[model samples]
Target: MTRQQAIVADLLHACAHPAVAGAALFALSADAIERARVGAARRRQSIGAFVAHSVADFARVASERDKALLARRMRGAPAPIVAGLEAILENPPRA
Candidate 1:
């Protein structure tokens, strides 16, 4: 696999691990923290919930973009490969 694909595969594997599944921790810049805090307050959600939702939304969009890229790259592939990729694009796994 290409470097980007390898990195994505590693991240997917890490996320699937029992200890890390559904939970993650990472540091953010002070500015970003303050912004998220304010946004959360506005939405009547806790900062953690807001950040989780935001991250989920971002992942969903990124997944769509990746699918689109895959579709473009599959333009001249064999029929079976194209069909398989089409199925995957149509039925992406739930986050």
Candidate 2:
């Protein structure tokens, strides 16, 4: 896993309840995570993985939640990445 992803994983695992530690784990709100999960599920992928790719790419995300989702996805990426995450949803990553 990438450095960022590993860090996130640490945070997630550290959580008293990983499932409930969305904000600290990913820097996103709970609702934002839900939206990201839904988006990923639509494409048949893991919410975590989808977030990893999106954040790694630094795409033009919409809300703070998107950013948070990206952080969460980074955790345990490639293992269960979020699915159906659309690149076109926001601006492309910076050069």
Candidate 3:
């Protein structure tokens, strides 16, 4: 198995409940898993590709959300989560 697939599998297997495992796997695979759900293995992409695309999409969302400069200037008391999110926006995740 590829490193990406292994990591995904490990994450799935670590789930304590059967339903949670299925839910996590379904979320990770998303479209690819749906293709397989209809008995179309040939139409499904690799789990690793799905994971990469999902991560890239989420990163884009994070970048866009952080792009609003006004977010850094919110008035009144700031929520702890917002403060932490602001810190993350100021300093991006390491590649």
Candidate 4:
């Protein structure tokens, strides 16, 4: 696991107990997080995962509903290296 992934895993207790917590939390850019939070509040919705949600939102724009669903389900919960999540969210996503 990468540093960020390891950190998140430790926070989620995945490192201490794999069976209980198989998920790994990834780090999202501050801008993306803020944008997601603000946008959600503006739209009267909750921000799920800015980076992952951005991907899914695009999938929806492309009319890939299934992909959007899956993507939204996956936001911030899993990734090969949690740090890479910053790349995904650096551009940020709006709600």
Q: What would you estimate as the lDDT of candidate 4?
A: 0.40
The TM-scores of all predictions, comma-separated, are 0.43, 0.34, 0.23, 0.35
Best to worst by TM-score, what's the order? 1, 4, 2, 3
Best by TM-score: 1
Q: Which stretches of candidate 4 lie over 4 Å from their true place?
A: 1-26, 49-54, 63-95
**How accurate locally, in lDDT, is each candidate?**
0.46, 0.45, 0.35, 0.40
Better of 2 and 4 by lDDT: 2
**Clashing pairs in model 1?**
none
Residue pairs with clashing backbones, model 4: none
lDDT of 3 by residue, 10-84 (tens): 332333233442344443324434532432234364433433333333244445344332233222323322332
Off by over 4 Å in 1: 1-26, 63-95
Give candidate 2's TM-score. 0.34
- Backbone clashes under 3 angstroms, per model: 0, 12, 0, 0
Candidate 4, run of 10 with poorest lDDT: 15-24
- Give residue 23's error in model 1 in angstroms: 8.5
List, residue by residue over 30-73, the lDDT tens digit for candidate 1: 55556556766988976656555544443455574664554454
